[model samples]
Target chain A: MINNQFLVFVKKEFAHVLRDRKTLLVLFGLPVMQILIFGFALTNEVKNASIVVLDQAKDHQSQRLIGRIGASRYFDIEGAVDDEEAIEQNLRSGKVKMALVIPSGFSYDLAHRNKAGLRIIADASDPNTANTLSNYLSSIIMDEQAELNANVPVPYTIIPEMRMLYNPQLKGVHNFVPGVMALVLMLVCVMMTAISIVREKETGTMEILLVSPFKPLLVILSKAVPYLLLSLVNVGTILLLSVFVLDLPVNGSILLLLAESTMFIITCLSIGLFISVKAQSQQTAMLISLMGMMLPTILFSGFMFPIENMPKPLQAITNIVPSRWYYIIVKSIMIKGLGFQAIWKETAILAGMAVFLTLVSLKNFKIRLE
Target chain B: METVIKTHELTKRYGDFIAANAISLEVYKGEIFGFLGANGAGKTTAMRMLCGLSTPSSGSAEIAGYDIYRQTEQVKKNIGYMSQKFSLYEDLTVMENIRFFGGIYGLGSKDIRLKGQALIKQLGLESEEKKLVGSLPLGWKQKLAFSVAILHSPKIVFLDEPTGGVDPLTRRQFWDLIYEAADRGITIFVTTHYMDEAEYCGRLSIMVDGNVKALDTPSALKEQYHATSMDDVFYELARGAKRSE
Candidate 1:
C-alpha cells in the first residue's frame, strides 16, 4: 500500500515537472545550452591570433621561420612591419596580438656562434593569450633549431622530451566537459529540487501535505526522486554532447562514470533538500541555491581555476565544496580513463557528503508547519 | 456527547512571546465548533495543534483517542485540514488533484475513482474536471477544496479561515457543505472572521488575547453579553486586544 502511494506521489511530481513549460525548458534546455556554449563558444584554446612580423634579417633562415609561423594554425602573420614603431602601433591598436622580431643576425650567427637570437613582443593586456603565444613561438623556434642540428652530433647535451598524456592536442573541450557536467548537474539538481519543494511552501500546499498521513521523510524523498531522474538524463545529455558533438571520448568505464555521476547527483539533491527546509519562499530558495551552490561549484571545482594557485584558506574552503571532488572524479574517469582505484577517495568523499547532507536536512525538515 | 478533541493547558511559545497560551477546551463529535478570534488571537495556532500540524510547548490533548504528541500520525489520519491559503495544487487538473490527494491518504483506487466522479458531479464540475484548478472561479475552488478535504471521511475537519475571500453567496453555499458534512457525523472545527458565519455554528468559542473568553451557544453568548448579535459580543471581547496583525 505504501509503495502504491509512493508511486502515485512520484507520478504527480513528474506531472508537475512536465506540465510547467518553463520548468521543462530549464530541465532540458539549460544543460544542452551550457554544453554547446562551453564546448564550442567559450574555449580557452587560442587559435588564429593575428601577429605582426619584423624580419630585419632579410635572409633565408628568417623568412623560413616566418613561413613556419604563418603555416602553423596558432597564428596568422597579418603583414610585415618595417620597424619596432610599426609593431608597437599594430599591437596598440589591437590589430595583432603579438609582434615577432627576428634580429638582423640572420643565418650568419647560427653558422658562426651556433646560436641565433629572436625576439617576441606579445600584447600583455590579455595575459593568458600573451603567455600562450610566446610559448608557441618559442617551441616552433626550438623545433627549427633541432632540425638544423639533426645531422651534426652535439656532445654532452641533455634534451628533455615532453609529452602530454591525456589530451595530446590540448583540446579545451576535454577539460571543460567535466566541469560543465559538474555545473549543469549541480544547478539542475539543487536549484530545481529546492525551488520545487519551496514552491509548495509558497503556494501553501505544504501545510496540506504535512497534515496528511504520509510520512515527512517520504514527502522529501518523493520530491527529490523526479529531479534525481532528470539530473541523470542531464548527465547523459552532457556525455553525449561531449562524445559526439565535442569529439571528446570517454576514456574510462562508462558504468563507473555514471555511478560517480549518480553519487554527485545525490549529493546535490541532499543540498537542495537542505535549502528547501530552511527557505520559506521559492525566491529565497532560488537565491540561496544560485549564490551558495553555483558560485562555489564554478570557482572551487578546479576546472576553471587551478586550486593550487588559490590562497591557502580558499583552498581549504574548496575542500568542502562537493563539486570540487566530483570535478576531480569526473576528470579521472572521463578524461584520464582511470579505474575506480584512481578515484576511490573522491567517490568516498561524495558519498559521505550525500549521507551527511541527507541526514542533516531530514532532521531539520519540520513535520509541523512551523 | 463523545469528545473527539480534548485539550488542557495547551501552549505554544516562541521565546518571549506566547502564540497560543495555556488553554483548555473540549469539542464534541459532529459539532460545528466555531473557533472565533481577532487578527492574532491564536485561532490558527490552536487549530494547528489540534490537527497535529504544530507541536505545543506544554500541552496534553487527545484527538480521536490518540495522543497529540505521541501518536501524531494517528491524529493526522483522523483529521482533515484546509488552510486560509488555497492549498490545492493550482497546476493540477481537478480530477488529478482528487486522485493525488486520495492516493496519498491511502485510499483504494476504486474508492478514489468513485469519490472523484461523485465529487465532480456534485460540484457540477464534470466539464472542468480536466481543466487546471488555476482557471477555476474562487467560489468553485473553495468548494472543491472543502470536498477534497473530507473525501477520506475523517472524524473531524479543521478549517482555518477556509472562506476568507469568497463572496457572501459562496460563503453561504460553503456553510451548506459544512452542514451536510456535519450531518454525516464529520465534526467541523472552523475559524472565521465573519460574525454572520459565526451564528451558523452549533457552539462557539470566542478567543481574546490567546484565551477562550467565552464558550457557549451563539444565542446564549448574546444573552450573557446583553448584545443584540454575535458581532457586538465579539467586539466586546476582542476590542481590548493588544495584538494586531
Candidate 2:
C-alpha cells in the first residue's frame, strides 16, 4: 500500500520542478540541443581540406597521383607547386593545411625499385587535424598504388583490408551521440537534484521537512523521484533525436536500453543526493555537481576522451567514475548490438555504484538538523 | 492545566563545549511561553532539542506527553516548528505550499483542500493564492509561514525568532496571529530578541550563559530585578555572563 504522505511529497516535488520554468527548460532542452549540436555541428572526419602539392618530378606518375588526390573528397588540390618555398609559403600563410612533396624520378623509381619517396608536411599546430589529414593522404596514395599494380605480379603487396564494423561509415555522430546522451542525463540529474535539495536547505524548507512526520529518507526519495522521471524523459528525447535526427539506430533491444537508462539515472540521482547532503548552499551544490561530477564524467568517462589513450593515472581515475561504465554500456547496447550478456559486467558496475552511493547518502543523511 | 511540554536537565554538548547546559522547564496547555536570550545564549539549541530536531546531551523531555528521545515520531506529529528564515517553497504557489505541508501531516485530500481554501480566504490571499510565495512581501510571507506551520492544528508550535526582522506594523500583526493561535488552545513556545514582544508572553524564561537566569511573569521579573522594563532586566542579567569572556 502506498503511503499517502509519500505520494504528497512526490507531488510537491513535481510542482516545484514544474513551477521553475528556467530549470525545467534546461532539464528538457539541454539534452536534445546537445545531441543535435554534438551530432550535426561537430565532427572529427577529414573533409575538404585544402592542400598544395610540390611535384619536383613533374612526371606522369606525379600528375596521376595529383589527379587521384584531387579526386578524393577528403582533400582539395589547390595547385601543383614547382618549389619547396611555394609550398612552405602556402603552409605558413594558412592557405593550405598540408603539402605533398613528390621527389624527382618518382615514376622511374617505382618502375625500377618498386618504391618511391614522398613526404607529407602538415601543420602540427593542430595535432589532431594534422594526424587525421596525414592518415587520409597516405591512405589515398596507397589506394592509387594498389590500383596501378592490380594486374601486375608483385613479390609482396600487404593490403590492409580495413573494415570498420558497427559504424561502417565512421560517422563521428555515431561515436558521440551516446556520449552526449550520458553526459546530458548525468549533468541534469546530478546537478538538478543537488541544487534542488540544497535549495530547500537554503530556503529553510529542509528543516521543516525534516521536522515533519515524513522520514528524512523519504524526503530525499521524493526529491529524487521527480528528477529521475525528468531524466527518463530526457533519455527519450535524446534517443529520439539520436535515432530520428542523427539517424543513429538502436541496434540492441529498446527495453534493455531503457532499463539501463533507468539504472544509470538512479546512479546519477544517488550522486546528486550525496552531493546535496554534503553541500550547505545551492551554489555549493551546483559547484560540486558540475566540477566534481559533470567535468569528470565528460573527461574521464570516455565521453570526449578515450580512457585507453589517457595517462595511466587518469585511466585509473576513470575507473572510479560511474559514467565510464555507463558510457561503455550504452555504446555496447546502442552500437555493438550487444545483449545483457555482453554488457552484464558494466551493468553490474553501474548497479553497484547506485547501491553504494545510495547507501552512503542514506547513511550520511541525518534526521536531525544538527 | 495539563502539561504540554516538560523537560528535566535538558542539555546539548558539542564535543568539549556545552552549548546548552543542564536546564529544566515546563510549559502548560494554551500558554504563551517566551524563551529569551542573547546571541549564542543557547535558546535555539534548547528549542531544537525539545522539537525533536536535536538530541540532548543529557536529560529527558516530553512533548504532547510523548518522550522526545524514544517517541520522536509521535512527538513530531504533535508539534509544529517555524524557524527565523523563510521556510516556504519560493517557487510553489501559496495554495501549493498549504496542500504540500498539509498532505505531509497526513491530512486527507478533501480536508487539505477545504483547509487550504479557508486559509487563503482568511489571509486575504484569495486573489494571490496562485502566486508564488517568493513574490510575496516579507510581512505577508511571515504570516503565511505561520499559518502553514499551524495548518495541521498541533498541540504546540515552536517558533525560533519568528519575528526577527520586519516593520513595526508587521511585527505587531505577526504577534496578533501568534495570540490568535494561542487563544485557540495551542501552546505557543517562541524565542525572540524583541523585549517588547517578550512582554506579550504570559510567562518568560530569559537564558544567559546556557542557564535560565530568570523565569517569571513579565511584571514579576521586572519587580524581582527592580527594572523599569524587560529590556533593562535582560541587560542586567546578561551583562555579566561568562560567555563574554
Candidate 3:
C-alpha cells in the first residue's frame, strides 16, 4: 500500500487545484480549445480558395485552360482583372489565394501544334495549401493531357478505389481531432504542473510543504493529481466533441483511449515537474514550458505535417518527444480502431517515457532538496 | 534538559564560499533558541541544513536524535518548519489546508478531521474554517502556518522568520504560540532578523557573513555589548561586522 502521506498529499493537491480556476483553464480549457482548433482549423484537405486570372489570351485555348482550371472546385476565380498589374495587386492584397495568367496565348499557336503556356500564381503564404493546390492543378492538367493522348470517344478513365483508411473520406478534421487532443493534453498537463510548482516556490508555499512531516515525493505527487484528473476530463471533452460536433470517427474502444491518455497525462506532469526544477519563478516556468514543450510538441508530433516526410534530424528528435508517441497512440486507437494488441507498443513507449521522466525528475528533486 | 539536537563541526559551503563554516551547537529539549543574522548571513543556509533540506558540507548534525545525512526521513517525521512566507496554501479553505498538511504527515482521515476541527477552534478560526487561507489576514495566516507546522506534535519546530510581514500585536501572539510549544517540551530553534523577537528567545546566536559572532541568552548578549535592547545589540554587532571587513 502507498504511504498515508502520499494519500494526504494527493488530497491536498486536489484541494489546491479545485481552488484555482486558472489552473483548471490551463489543464482542461486549453486542451479543449486546442482540440477544436486542430480538428477544425488545421485541416489538410483543399477547399474553396480565392483566385484571380489575367487572361492575356482571350482565345479558345485560354478560355479552355481557364475553364479546365476553374472547373475543379479547389480554385474559385474571385475576380477577372486586366493585365499583370491587376493580378499582382490582387495577389499581393491577399484577395486571391491563387491567380492564373494565360500570358498572351493564341489559339493559332496551339492549332499549329506549338506549346501553350499558362502562368499559375497562388498565395503561397499558407505554404501547405499552396503546395497542395499546386499539386492538384498539375494533376488536373496531366489528366487532361493523358486524355488527349489516348484520344477515343470513350478515353480510358482512371477510377481509384481509394480508402483513406482511418480517416476515410479524407476529412482534415479526422487527423486534427487526434492531433489536437494530444497536443492540448501535453501542453495543459505539462504547463500547469510546472507553473503550479513554481507558484509555490515564488509564494513561499513550497518551504512549508517541504518542512512538514511529509516526504518530498508526496508533495510533488499531490501537485500532480489535480492536473491528471483535469487532463482526463479534457480527453473526454475532446472525445465528445469529435463525435458529436465534428462527426469524427472513433472506431477504437474509448477505455483504451482513456488508458493511453492517462499515461500521457502522467508523462506531461513529469515534464512540468522537471521544468519546475529548472525554473525558480512562475513566469520562468511558463516561458520554459511554452518555448520548450508546447512549440516542440506542435512541430514534431505529426500535428500539422507528416513526421515521415520531415528531415532526418527532425525524425531523430521526434524519438525524444513524448507527444510524438502519444499522437501515434491516439491516432491508432481513435482513428485506426486499433486494439491494445496493436497499440501495446506505443502504449509501452508512452509508459516508459512517463516512468523515465517521472523518475528522473523525482531523482533530481530528491538530490536538490537533500 | 537533554540535548534534542546536536551538530559536530557542521559546515556548508556554496562553491568556494563558506555559507556555514564548521558551525557546532546543541539545543536541549524545550529550549527556545534564536538564530540571528543579516541578509545572506548563512542563517537560512544553516536552518536549511538542520531541517534536512540541505546537506552539510563535511560534518554532521543530528535532528531529533537522527543523523542529518543518513536518517533524514526520520528527522523529517519529528520536526516542523515555518518560513517567513507562512507556506500555507492560500487558495484552500483553512480546514482543507489543515487536512492536507495533516494527511501528508500520515494522519488518518478521521484523525485529520477531528484534530483539524480542534485546531480551527484553538486558533479562534472556527467561524472561518471554510474560508480560503488567502482571504485571511497575514497575522492569521502566520498563526495558522505555525499551528499546522507542529500539528502532528513533532519533537522540534524550526521557525524561519515566522513573524515577518505581520503587525506587532500579531508578532507577540505568534511568540506566545512558540513559547507554549517550547513549554510543552518541544525544541524551538528559530531564525529571525527582528531583534525584539530575538529577545523572546531563551538562547540566541548571532551570525554575520556565515560566522557565528555570538551564541548566548538575549540577556547575556545585551550585557556583553553594553546595549539596552536586543535591537541595539544586533546593530552594534552588525555595524561591527562592517568595520572588521
Top model number, lDDT: 1
Give model 1's TM-score for chain A to 2 decimal places: 0.68
**Better lDDT candidate (2, 3):** 2
Report the C-alpha displacement of residue B240, candidate 2, in angstroms.
1.1
- lDDT tens digits by residue: candidate 2, A1-370: 1289889889888887887789878888788778777766654566899998888888887788899989999999898888878877887887788888887867777787777778778865554456557668878888888888887776223232322222234433335767887898889899989998888888888889878888887888888888888888888888888788765678899899999999999999999988988999998999998899889988888877767668899899998898888888898998788999998998898889989988888877774353
Better of 1 and 2 by lDDT: 1
lDDT of 3 at B213: 86
Q: Please give the lDDT score for candidate 2.
A: 0.85
The weakest ten consecutive residues by lDDT in model 1 chain B span B45-54
lDDT of 3 at B235: 86
Which stretches in model 2 have alpha-carbon errors above 4 Å? A42-174, A367-370
A197: Cα error in model 1, Å: 1.0
Instruction: Point to the candidate with the largest TM-score.
Output: 1
Per-candidate TM equals 0.81, 0.80, 0.76
Please write out the lDDT profile of model 3 over residues B1-245, one tens digit for every residue.
68988988888987898888788888889999999988877888899999887778888888888988787779888999888675888878898888877877777788888888878888899889999898999899999989998888899999898888888999999899888898888999999878888888899899887788889999998899999999988888787554232
What residue pairs clash in candidate 3, if any at all?
Answer: none
Rank all candidate structures by their DockQ, best first, as comma-separated numbers: 1, 2, 3
Model 1 Cα lDDT, one tens digit per residue, B142-172: 9999999999999999999999998999999
**Each model: TM-score of chain B?**
0.98, 0.98, 0.95
Q: What is the Cα-based lDDT of residue A259 in candidate 2?
A: 97
> How displaced is residue B107 in candidate 1, in Å?
0.3
Candidate 1 per-residue lDDT over residues A90-119, each given as its tens digit: 888987888887778757777776666677
